[model samples]
Target: MAEETRTASRARAVALIADVVRWAGIIAAVILVIHVILVAGEANPANGIARTIHNLADALSLGFKDLFNKPADDPKLRTLINYGLAALFWLVVSSVAARLIRRLA
Candidate 1:
Protein backbone atom coordinates (compact mmCIF):
# COMPACT_ATOMS: atom_id res chain seq x y z
CA MET A 1 0.00 0.00 0.00
CA ALA A 2 2.78 2.48 0.86
CA GLU A 3 4.61 1.67 -2.37
CA GLU A 4 1.46 2.19 -4.37
CA THR A 5 0.84 5.54 -2.69
CA ARG A 6 4.38 6.66 -3.44
CA THR A 7 4.02 5.69 -7.09
CA ALA A 8 0.73 7.48 -7.36
CA SER A 9 2.18 10.64 -5.82
CA ARG A 10 5.12 10.55 -8.20
CA ALA A 11 2.82 10.16 -11.16
CA ARG A 12 0.71 13.10 -10.06
CA ALA A 13 3.78 15.28 -9.67
CA VAL A 14 4.90 14.36 -13.17
CA ALA A 15 1.47 15.17 -14.58
CA LEU A 16 1.50 18.56 -12.88
CA ILE A 17 4.92 19.31 -14.26
CA ALA A 18 3.81 18.27 -17.71
CA ASP A 19 0.82 20.55 -17.63
CA VAL A 20 2.94 23.51 -16.55
CA VAL A 21 5.46 22.77 -19.28
CA ARG A 22 2.77 22.52 -21.98
CA TRP A 23 1.36 25.89 -21.02
CA ALA A 24 4.84 27.38 -20.97
CA GLY A 25 5.40 26.17 -24.54
CA ILE A 26 2.17 27.79 -25.69
CA ILE A 27 3.04 31.09 -24.03
CA ALA A 28 6.59 31.05 -25.32
CA ALA A 29 5.40 30.41 -28.87
CA VAL A 30 2.98 33.30 -28.65
CA ILE A 31 5.66 35.63 -27.34
CA LEU A 32 8.10 34.58 -30.05
CA VAL A 33 5.52 35.18 -32.76
CA ILE A 34 4.74 38.63 -31.41
CA HIS A 35 8.42 39.55 -31.20
CA VAL A 36 9.00 38.36 -34.75
CA ILE A 37 6.11 40.41 -36.03
CA LEU A 38 7.25 43.56 -34.23
CA VAL A 39 10.83 43.11 -35.39
CA ALA A 40 9.74 42.44 -38.94
CA GLY A 41 7.67 45.59 -39.04
CA GLU A 42 10.44 47.73 -37.58
CA ALA A 43 13.38 46.25 -39.45
CA ASN A 44 14.11 45.99 -43.13
CA PRO A 45 14.38 42.44 -44.40
CA ALA A 46 17.74 43.25 -45.93
CA ASN A 47 19.23 44.09 -42.54
CA GLY A 48 20.93 41.43 -40.42
CA ILE A 49 18.94 40.37 -37.38
CA ALA A 50 21.67 41.31 -34.92
CA ARG A 51 22.20 44.69 -36.54
CA THR A 52 18.49 45.33 -36.61
CA ILE A 53 18.16 44.64 -32.92
CA HIS A 54 21.14 46.89 -32.19
CA ASN A 55 19.68 49.67 -34.28
CA LEU A 56 16.33 49.33 -32.60
CA ALA A 57 17.91 49.51 -29.16
CA ASP A 58 19.78 52.62 -30.17
CA ALA A 59 16.71 54.31 -31.61
CA LEU A 60 14.55 53.35 -28.64
CA SER A 61 17.19 54.63 -26.23
CA LEU A 62 17.43 57.93 -28.02
CA GLY A 63 13.68 58.32 -28.13
CA PHE A 64 13.40 57.41 -24.48
CA LYS A 65 16.02 59.99 -23.58
CA ASP A 66 14.32 62.68 -25.60
CA LEU A 67 11.03 61.96 -23.93
CA PHE A 68 12.64 61.92 -20.52
CA ASN A 69 14.04 65.37 -21.13
CA LYS A 70 10.60 66.73 -21.81
CA PRO A 71 7.58 66.48 -19.48
CA ALA A 72 9.15 63.38 -17.89
CA ASP A 73 5.63 62.07 -17.46
CA ASP A 74 4.38 61.85 -21.03
CA PRO A 75 1.99 59.02 -21.90
CA LYS A 76 3.93 58.11 -25.02
CA LEU A 77 7.13 57.81 -23.03
CA ARG A 78 5.42 55.59 -20.49
CA THR A 79 4.05 53.43 -23.27
CA LEU A 80 7.46 52.99 -24.83
CA ILE A 81 9.03 52.03 -21.50
CA ASN A 82 6.21 49.62 -20.84
CA TYR A 83 6.67 47.97 -24.20
CA GLY A 84 10.43 47.68 -23.74
CA LEU A 85 10.06 46.16 -20.26
CA ALA A 86 7.34 43.82 -21.46
CA ALA A 87 9.52 42.63 -24.32
CA LEU A 88 12.41 41.94 -21.96
CA PHE A 89 10.09 40.20 -19.51
CA TRP A 90 8.79 37.98 -22.27
CA LEU A 91 12.33 37.08 -23.32
CA VAL A 92 13.18 35.94 -19.79
CA VAL A 93 9.92 34.03 -19.61
CA SER A 94 10.63 32.34 -22.90
CA SER A 95 14.03 31.25 -21.68
CA VAL A 96 12.43 29.68 -18.62
CA ALA A 97 9.82 28.12 -20.86
CA ALA A 98 12.53 26.50 -22.95
CA ARG A 99 14.03 24.96 -19.85
CA LEU A 100 10.70 23.56 -18.75
CA ILE A 101 10.01 22.21 -22.23
CA ARG A 102 13.36 20.48 -22.26
CA ARG A 103 12.76 18.94 -18.87
CA LEU A 104 9.26 17.75 -19.70
CA ALA A 105 10.18 16.49 -23.14
Candidate 2:
Protein backbone atom coordinates (compact mmCIF):
# COMPACT_ATOMS: atom_id res chain seq x y z
CA MET A 1 0.00 0.00 0.00
CA ALA A 2 2.85 2.41 0.84
CA GLU A 3 4.55 1.66 -2.50
CA GLU A 4 1.32 2.32 -4.39
CA THR A 5 0.86 5.61 -2.57
CA ARG A 6 4.40 6.69 -3.52
CA THR A 7 3.80 5.83 -7.17
CA ALA A 8 0.61 7.89 -7.24
CA SER A 9 2.29 10.84 -5.60
CA ARG A 10 5.09 10.74 -8.16
CA ALA A 11 2.56 10.63 -10.96
CA ARG A 12 0.76 13.66 -9.54
CA ALA A 13 4.01 15.61 -9.37
CA VAL A 14 4.80 14.85 -12.98
CA ALA A 15 1.36 16.01 -14.07
CA LEU A 16 1.81 19.26 -12.18
CA ILE A 17 5.19 19.93 -13.83
CA ALA A 18 3.76 19.15 -17.24
CA ASP A 19 0.89 21.58 -16.78
CA VAL A 20 3.28 24.35 -15.73
CA VAL A 21 5.54 23.75 -18.72
CA ARG A 22 2.57 23.79 -21.08
CA TRP A 23 1.38 27.11 -19.71
CA ALA A 24 4.88 28.59 -19.89
CA GLY A 25 5.20 27.67 -23.55
CA ILE A 26 1.83 29.23 -24.31
CA ILE A 27 2.75 32.42 -22.47
CA ALA A 28 6.09 32.72 -24.23
CA ALA A 29 4.52 32.26 -27.62
CA VAL A 30 1.92 34.94 -26.90
CA ILE A 31 4.61 37.32 -25.67
CA LEU A 32 6.71 36.76 -28.78
CA VAL A 33 3.76 37.45 -31.05
CA ILE A 34 2.93 40.68 -29.22
CA HIS A 35 6.56 41.76 -29.39
CA VAL A 36 6.64 41.20 -33.14
CA ILE A 37 3.55 43.34 -33.59
CA LEU A 38 5.00 46.10 -31.43
CA VAL A 39 8.26 45.97 -33.36
CA ALA A 40 6.39 46.30 -36.63
CA GLY A 41 4.89 49.59 -35.43
CA GLU A 42 8.47 51.05 -35.18
CA ALA A 43 7.32 53.95 -32.97
CA ASN A 44 6.59 52.14 -29.73
CA PRO A 45 8.82 52.10 -26.64
CA ALA A 46 9.68 48.54 -27.59
CA ASN A 47 11.31 50.05 -30.63
CA GLY A 48 13.81 51.73 -28.35
CA ILE A 49 15.10 48.37 -27.20
CA ALA A 50 15.18 47.14 -30.76
CA ARG A 51 17.04 50.30 -31.82
CA THR A 52 19.58 49.87 -29.07
CA ILE A 53 20.12 46.27 -30.16
CA HIS A 54 20.54 47.43 -33.75
CA ASN A 55 23.07 50.07 -32.74
CA LEU A 56 25.00 47.54 -30.71
CA ALA A 57 25.10 45.25 -33.71
CA ASP A 58 26.33 48.11 -35.82
CA ALA A 59 29.08 48.86 -33.32
CA LEU A 60 30.08 45.18 -33.26
CA SER A 61 30.15 45.04 -37.04
CA LEU A 62 32.34 48.10 -37.08
CA GLY A 63 34.71 46.64 -34.51
CA PHE A 64 34.76 43.33 -36.32
CA LYS A 65 34.70 44.62 -39.86
CA ASP A 66 36.58 41.61 -41.04
CA LEU A 67 33.85 39.41 -39.54
CA PHE A 68 31.05 40.70 -41.75
CA ASN A 69 31.46 41.93 -45.28
CA LYS A 70 29.71 45.05 -46.56
CA PRO A 71 26.29 44.74 -48.25
CA ALA A 72 26.03 41.06 -47.38
CA ASP A 73 26.35 41.87 -43.68
CA ASP A 74 24.88 44.87 -41.91
CA PRO A 75 23.65 45.78 -38.45
CA LYS A 76 20.02 45.35 -39.42
CA LEU A 77 20.79 42.05 -41.08
CA ARG A 78 22.68 40.76 -38.09
CA THR A 79 19.92 41.84 -35.73
CA LEU A 80 17.35 40.01 -37.81
CA ILE A 81 19.48 36.90 -37.93
CA ASN A 82 20.15 37.00 -34.20
CA TYR A 83 16.53 37.55 -33.33
CA GLY A 84 15.40 34.80 -35.65
CA LEU A 85 17.88 32.37 -34.17
CA ALA A 86 16.87 33.30 -30.64
CA ALA A 87 13.20 32.87 -31.37
CA LEU A 88 13.84 29.50 -32.90
CA PHE A 89 15.90 28.47 -29.93
CA TRP A 90 13.24 29.46 -27.44
CA LEU A 91 10.45 27.83 -29.40
CA VAL A 92 12.26 24.54 -29.70
CA VAL A 93 13.46 24.52 -26.12
CA SER A 94 10.07 25.37 -24.71
CA SER A 95 8.35 22.83 -26.92
CA VAL A 96 10.76 20.05 -26.07
CA ALA A 97 10.54 20.84 -22.38
CA ALA A 98 6.79 20.76 -22.56
CA ARG A 99 6.84 17.45 -24.40
CA LEU A 100 9.17 15.87 -21.91
CA ILE A 101 7.06 17.09 -19.04
CA ARG A 102 3.91 15.80 -20.69
CA ARG A 103 5.51 12.41 -21.20
CA LEU A 104 6.56 12.28 -17.59
CA ALA A 105 3.09 13.25 -16.56
Candidate 3:
Protein backbone atom coordinates (compact mmCIF):
# COMPACT_ATOMS: atom_id res chain seq x y z
CA MET A 1 0.00 0.00 0.00
CA ALA A 2 1.08 3.59 -0.53
CA GLU A 3 0.75 4.26 3.16
CA GLU A 4 3.08 1.40 4.05
CA THR A 5 5.63 2.53 1.46
CA ARG A 6 5.58 6.05 2.84
CA THR A 7 6.06 4.75 6.37
CA ALA A 8 9.01 2.65 5.31
CA SER A 9 10.56 5.56 3.50
CA ARG A 10 10.20 7.74 6.58
CA ALA A 11 11.77 5.08 8.75
CA ARG A 12 14.73 4.80 6.40
CA ALA A 13 15.18 8.55 6.40
CA VAL A 14 15.10 8.66 10.17
CA ALA A 15 17.65 5.88 10.43
CA LEU A 16 19.94 7.65 7.99
CA ILE A 17 19.76 10.87 9.93
CA ALA A 18 20.37 9.09 13.20
CA ASP A 19 23.38 7.30 11.77
CA VAL A 20 24.87 10.51 10.45
CA VAL A 21 24.46 12.24 13.78
CA ARG A 22 25.93 9.29 15.62
CA TRP A 23 28.98 9.21 13.37
CA ALA A 24 29.48 12.93 13.69
CA GLY A 25 29.44 12.69 17.46
CA ILE A 26 31.86 9.81 17.41
CA ILE A 27 34.27 11.65 15.10
CA ALA A 28 34.06 14.78 17.21
CA ALA A 29 34.78 12.81 20.34
CA VAL A 30 37.79 11.18 18.70
CA ILE A 31 39.15 14.53 17.59
CA LEU A 32 38.70 15.92 21.07
CA VAL A 33 40.50 12.96 22.58
CA ILE A 34 43.42 13.37 20.18
CA HIS A 35 43.58 17.03 20.98
CA VAL A 36 43.61 16.33 24.68
CA ILE A 37 46.35 13.77 24.31
CA LEU A 38 48.52 16.01 22.21
CA VAL A 39 48.11 18.87 24.65
CA ALA A 40 48.63 16.82 27.77
CA GLY A 41 51.63 15.09 26.32
CA GLU A 42 53.18 18.42 25.46
CA ALA A 43 53.46 17.37 21.86
CA ASN A 44 55.86 19.29 19.71
CA PRO A 45 54.01 21.78 17.58
CA ALA A 46 56.61 21.41 14.83
CA ASN A 47 55.71 17.77 14.40
CA GLY A 48 53.24 16.95 11.62
CA ILE A 49 50.95 14.68 13.67
CA ALA A 50 50.62 17.11 16.55
CA ARG A 51 49.99 20.01 14.23
CA THR A 52 47.35 18.09 12.32
CA ILE A 53 45.46 17.10 15.45
CA HIS A 54 45.65 20.59 16.89
CA ASN A 55 44.32 22.05 13.68
CA LEU A 56 41.47 19.56 13.50
CA ALA A 57 40.46 20.15 17.09
CA ASP A 58 40.62 23.87 16.66
CA ALA A 59 38.34 23.67 13.64
CA LEU A 60 35.87 21.35 15.31
CA SER A 61 35.73 23.53 18.43
CA LEU A 62 35.28 26.80 16.65
CA GLY A 63 32.49 28.08 18.90
CA PHE A 64 33.84 26.70 22.15
CA LYS A 65 37.51 27.56 21.73
CA ASP A 66 37.42 30.28 24.35
CA LEU A 67 34.69 28.98 26.60
CA PHE A 68 37.22 28.58 29.41
CA ASN A 69 40.49 30.40 29.28
CA LYS A 70 42.73 29.01 31.95
CA PRO A 71 45.76 30.84 33.24
CA ALA A 72 48.72 31.01 30.90
CA ASP A 73 50.97 29.30 33.42
CA ASP A 74 48.71 26.24 33.48
CA PRO A 75 48.56 24.90 29.93
CA LYS A 76 47.46 21.45 31.06
CA LEU A 77 44.43 22.80 32.89
CA ARG A 78 43.47 24.91 29.93
CA THR A 79 43.65 21.99 27.54
CA LEU A 80 41.49 19.85 29.81
CA ILE A 81 38.75 22.42 30.21
CA ASN A 82 38.62 23.44 26.57
CA TYR A 83 38.70 19.92 25.17
CA GLY A 84 36.13 18.70 27.69
CA LEU A 85 33.81 21.53 26.74
CA ALA A 86 34.21 20.71 23.06
CA ALA A 87 33.38 17.06 23.65
CA LEU A 88 30.33 17.97 25.69
CA PHE A 89 29.17 20.38 23.03
CA TRP A 90 29.32 17.77 20.29
CA LEU A 91 27.55 15.15 22.39
CA VAL A 92 24.71 17.47 23.38
CA VAL A 93 24.21 18.79 19.85
CA SER A 94 24.21 15.32 18.30
CA SER A 95 21.79 13.97 20.92
CA VAL A 96 19.35 16.82 20.37
CA ALA A 97 19.58 16.36 16.60
CA ALA A 98 18.87 12.64 16.84
CA ARG A 99 15.95 13.25 19.15
CA LEU A 100 14.45 15.82 16.83
CA ILE A 101 14.84 13.54 13.84
CA ARG A 102 13.12 10.70 15.69
CA ARG A 103 10.27 12.95 16.77
CA LEU A 104 9.80 14.27 13.29
CA ALA A 105 9.90 10.83 11.80
* lDDT per residue as tens, model 3, 66-101: 777767788878887888789888988898888888
Provide the lowest-lDDT 10-residue window in model 3. Answer: 62-71
Pairs with steric clashes in candidate 3: none
For this target, which candidate reaches the highest TM-score against the unseen true structure?
Answer: 3
Name the lDDT value of residue 48 in candidate 3: 95
Model 1: weakest 10-residue lDDT segment is 60-69
Q: Model 1 Cα displacement at 49 (Å)?
A: 20
Question: Model 2, range 1-105, lDDT digits (tens) per residue?
Answer: 999999899988887887787666555544444444444455345566655644443333333323334346454454344444444555666778877876755
Give the per-residue lDDT digits (tens) of candidate 1, residues 1-105.
999999788877866776675565455444434444545456554667646644454443333323334436553444345445544554566567656655664
lDDT of 1 at 37: 53
Off by over 4 Å in 2: 46-85, 102-105
Better of 1 and 3 by TM-score: 3
lDDT, residue 95, model 3? 83
Q: Predict model 2's lDDT versus the native.
A: 0.54
What's model 1's TM-score? 0.35
